[model samples]
Target: MVPEPSSEAPAKSFTDIQTRNGSIYTHPGLLSLPPSSGTSSSSGKRHRFSIIVPESVTDQIILKCKAIASGTSVTHVFIAALAMALSELQPPKEESYAVRYVNHSMINLRPYCRAPYNTREHAAAPYHTVSAQALGIDLVVPGPPIDGKDDGQINELSQVATQVRDYFRTVRPTSSQDEQIAVSPLMFKSLTTPPGSDPHIVSDPPFCPAVISSLGNIGSIVSASHGPFELTNVWAASEPIGAGVAIFLGTWNGRIELSGVFDTRYHDSGYIRKFLERMLDSVSGGLDVDNCTAPIRVTPNEEK
Candidate 1:
């Protein structure tokens, strides 16, 4: 959670994320996750911002964290990092919030969907399930000098990672895989349906605000070129369904990437840029906590 919102002012932070170039800490309203299926009636422009992480960093974190404990994957650490970033940054309000619980949703149904339904050909949709009620508060955000070996930053991050890992591990489906194929037409359309509609489906833990799918080593699937059209790069994003935002993660070429999509109508771009910088800072710091002894400034090699 946050230390406290200052009496002076705040840097745009969030109950939600900022715009591609916009800030999420503007209006004083619901920064709900698994945003309401219906598009926001309040209009605003949308913007996208993205950054790539070095492959070296990804590999190191994976190797080190994997050795820390069972189920301590790099994905777990990244979730901790995301929670840390969200807590530290201020949402756009007259006064920022003192974070208590992080309202986040994580959804990936591809593995659960069967056959043609799983592929994009049949419109493999993403869902947003939100609960105004906050979830558990076991996550801990690491503080300064994260690179210092004596501060226990790594241990703290590791604990947070473990908590996240355990949560998913414990909640992983106990039922057979076939039971998960409940994505009926009503359930699927309900994601984008307005509240007035009747779709009596209830999603446990609700859909997450974030939908991250690892696009492992992109070079594996993509061909070098298609006829005369050469393929140099690929960028992807799962935009916010309602007034909120969504982030995507993957590895391409030699770098890991993060892309955030938000509407400029609700967020301010300048502030969002600052927010993104802080997030990258947290990610780099957390990843390097176990490697380098001295602190270092990691720069973005590419952008989206």
Candidate 2:
């Protein structure tokens, strides 16, 4: 498993989260999308965009993240980059300190289930974990510089990313996790077949959601030439539900490829494009890997 998400957030915490939605404040205009009929991914109303991060940049980000903590992984790098993008797109409001964001990642249960059920691909459960200081205004703007460079942002990014890493690291295999995997099929059925005007979900929709799912290193599972076929490219996406977008990422052939999709009802293609652009922009930095310290991160190329 490259990385899987933690348990779903509690409803009590969710109530507190809505009161402080950072994503909404960061880009209020983005939510005012064009009128759309499509409501879900299955409704044929999803827009998409893809990103292929340079291998060098990917390695740099990964290394910098590891400096934050020995346990930090690629997923944490993305999470930090995501927090940066959300913050950079718009300045935070005066009350931005209350803003929050939720990360929704699915848990692949094949490793936990028995041989007969292990083969099931949909044997996964959704996990929504909220952060206390997501996209915090103080994380970036008006921050001190490190070594005459904006390494302050780097340190901040690492802090944000490491928090997520630590949260997941604390999770262990539990009976609840096993139960969620077992009932995943019923959850899937609920998605396709709504109970009524309001569909019942296994968990509440995430607040200021950043739904990220990593397919890990696809190169490990897929080969370029299999039998008589040559694989040139592979594309995949899981469309957004509710009000946020979903990002599906995988590393292939030394490059980290990412695809993000959102329902038109909640977003415009341009909005999604801009959102992803900001995200990749945060990742595609030209920083000296050598300049980075365990407590400091290299600044983005534009900043330098």
Highest TM-score model number: 2
User: TM-score for all predictions?
Assistant: 0.57, 0.60
Candidate 1: residue 145 Cα off by (Å)? 15
RMSD of each: 13.7, 10.1
Candidate 2 weakest lDDT stretch, 10 residues: 295-304
Per-residue accuracy of model 1 over 93-198 as CA lDDT, tens digit each: 3333433334333434544444555565666444333211122333222344434532343225666777777766643433322111222222233347686864
lDDT string for model 2 (113-166, tens) is 444444535444323222322233234342344466653333255667777776
lDDT of 2 at 24: 34
Please give the lDDT score for candidate 2: 0.51
The per-model lDDT (C-alpha) reads 0.47, 0.51
- Flag regions of model 1 displaced more than 4 Å: 1-43, 90-98, 101-155, 171-192, 195-217, 289-304
Residue-level lDDT for 182 in candidate 1 = 29
RMSD of 2: 10.1
